[model samples]
Target: MPHMFTISPDFPPNSLAGWYIFNTWFQKNTGLNIHLNLYNSFEEQTIAIDNNKNDIVYVNPVDAVRLVRDKGFLPIARVKNRLDEVVIAVSEENPISMMCGLKPDLKLAMTANPDVNMISMMLLEAVDLNNSNVVKTTYDSYIIVVKNILKGEADAGLFLAKAYDDLSNVVKKQLKILLRSDVEELYHSLLIGPELADRQDEIQTLLVSMTDNPVGKGVLEALDFEGWLKIENEEMEFMIDLIDTLVPDTD
Candidate 1:
């Protein structure tokens, strides 16, 4: 069977084509049978991981903990200059002028995406809001989260920064961005499972050098990445530890 490669569903939907192109590029270069398996939601992908051996996977910070610490996956590379940031927003007409002004019994829309949820909770700490104070409505995607907020179903919504930026101008104008997290160190990474340990050096080398060629550069552009950066072991551990500290045990 071909080695399966998949990306986190939290990635921009528009990048689907680029991933396909990347799969083709990877196969051509290494002469390996690399299949690009896709999942529409994070739950679907999680279920898949539990069911099968995914040789190469690209996932966000939260999922990385499971893949690395639990599943024997090694973090190889991450996209350069692409950090996972959260944007908390509300309907433009809402009277809540500041983050701290948001009070209890508020309706909050968000996805079950762990890192975003964790960061959102931490951000709300500025206002002394806890999960108990706000009633959170989980959505399948950021689009739905924004939709709920705009329709008054939610007082505010938490979104992945990239997802929020991808929204059309028409949609963005009706929503007010309350605040965005500036966590500059966290990002999604391309990881290789234990089964592919032999190819670690090869995969990492190709990824980091993609910027040298036009075809690879185009693929990077399609994914909205400037380039790839090698993730050192110590730095990777630091990122995981930081996440543990930022989010409490109760969260």
Candidate 2:
């Protein structure tokens, strides 16, 4: 049977097709029959994960930790230098200069990315803020999150740093970044299940050495990656440990 390769639904919409292209490249290069599966919703994906055996995944930090710890997946690589930082922002007119200025009942706009939300919540810890103390309004994307803040429906916005960077200069100037988390180590990763255990080294080498060839360079351009880099087990463990320390499991 062909190996199942899945990507997190949180990837930017523009990059959706890029993953398919990369899958074709991967199959061509690796001479392996890999099937790509992109889920429409996390809930639907969760159901599939519970009943299925996924061979490979490119996922966000939150899921990365989950798969490594619970599903016994092996971290192989991450997009080059792609740390998953969170950006907390407020409207230009709002007077909250620092996170300390935050208080109970402050309205927050955010997307459904749990990793970004978790880190944003950690930033709110500066003022001892938690979901109970703040009001959260979920948006379909970062753009809408900013829209809510600009329109005064939300007092603040939480964003993935790359999404914030992609916003137009005009829109960005109308808001202020109260803070951008700089944990530096949290990032998404490509992982493989035990089914691919024997081929781990082979797959890792192909990913990390993508920049060495023209075909590989073309695929990287489509995916908007500088290149790929190996995810050392030790580094991944520290990130998992940090996540465990930052966010404890609750029933």
Best by lDDT: 1
lDDT by candidate, in order shown: 0.87, 0.85
lDDT tens digits by residue: candidate 2, 108-167 = 999877788888987887798987889998877788888899999999999888878778
lDDT of 1 by residue, 44-139 (tens): 889888776587899888888778877888879998888999999999999887898798888999987888888988889788898889899888
Q: Best by TM-score, which number? A: 1
lDDT of 2 at 127: 91
- lDDT for predicted candidate 1 compared with the true structure: 0.87
Off by over 4 Å in 1: none
Candidate 2 structure lDDT: 0.85
Residue 116, model 2: lDDT of 88
lDDT of 1 at 165: 95
TM-scores of the candidates in the order shown: 0.96, 0.90
Off by over 4 Å in 2: 249-251
